[model samples]
Target: MALSIVYGILTTVLTATSWRLGLAVDGILWLVFLVPIILAVIGIINAVNGKMKPLPVIGGIKILK
Candidate 1:
């Protein structure tokens, strides 16, 4: 849930910027968008595979822990 929210927010914010700045900004938005998704994907993969894989900075920076 957290991963989804983080990615969704970043994606929306950056995408909004991209609308005015064009391709380079769009590319950056894409890059920023992947950060949280990659974490969630890794987490899902680890959970499904029966292992613990911490998402780089975020898994360590747990606010609700």
Candidate 2:
């Protein structure tokens, strides 16, 4: 959610500056979008299996440790 917001701002600024840069950033973001989907699927699978497994990458971030 936050990522999308930041991406939106960046895309707007980059596109306003140069269409090519915006195009490149947009392309990269599309690929990056897959990460969240993968993580969500993993989380759902873990929950359904009644397993307390941490997600990859951002999973190690603990705010209530």
Candidate 3:
């Protein structure tokens, strides 16, 4: 989420400064945003199926004690 926000801010700044660079970075933004969504889906599926598995990338994140 933070990465997405940072990237979005960067893209906005870049766009304000240079349209071309911003456009290029914007193309890659989809990938950055897709990761969290995919992870969430995976987590939900795992939970529904009664499996306790670690998620890729941020699975180790301890949101709750």
Candidate 4:
């Protein structure tokens, strides 16, 4: 969530300053955004079966705790 927001903001800033850089940043951000959704889906499946599992990659970074 926070990471997505940060990427969005950075992409916006880069867009205003440099179109090429903004496109590059946006592409990278697109990939980054998918990670959370995938993790959330995995988490949901785990929860439905009565298990608590952290997401891979970004799971340990407790930003909102």
All models: lDDT?
0.71, 0.90, 0.87, 0.85
Error of 3 at 34 (Å): 2.0
In model 2, the runs with Cα more than 4 Å from the true position are 38-65
Mark the regions of model 3 whose C-alpha exceeds 4 Å error after superposition: 1-9, 58-65
Per-prediction CA RMSD (Å): 6.6, 3.3, 4.1, 5.4
lDDT of 4 by residue, 1-65 (tens): 78768887899999999999999989887987787799888888898999867776667888885
- How much is the lDDT of residue 34 in candidate 2? 82
Best by lDDT: 2
What is the clash count of model 3? 0
Model 1 — TM-score against the truth? 0.52
Model with the higher lDDT, candidate 2 or 3: 2
**On residues 1-65, what C-alpha lDDT tens digit does candidate 1 reach at each position?**
78557656765776677755555555675687688798888788888999977766766786774
- Weakest ten-residue segment in model 3 by summed lDDT: 27-36
The Cα error of candidate 2 at residue 35, in Å, is 2.7
TM per candidate comes to 0.52, 0.56, 0.58, 0.51
lDDT of 2 by residue, 14-40 (tens): 999999999999999988998779888
List the pairs of residues colliding in candidate 2.
none
Candidate 3 pairs with clashing backbones? none
TM match of model 3 to true structure: 0.58
Number of the top-ranking candidate, with TM-score as the measure: 3
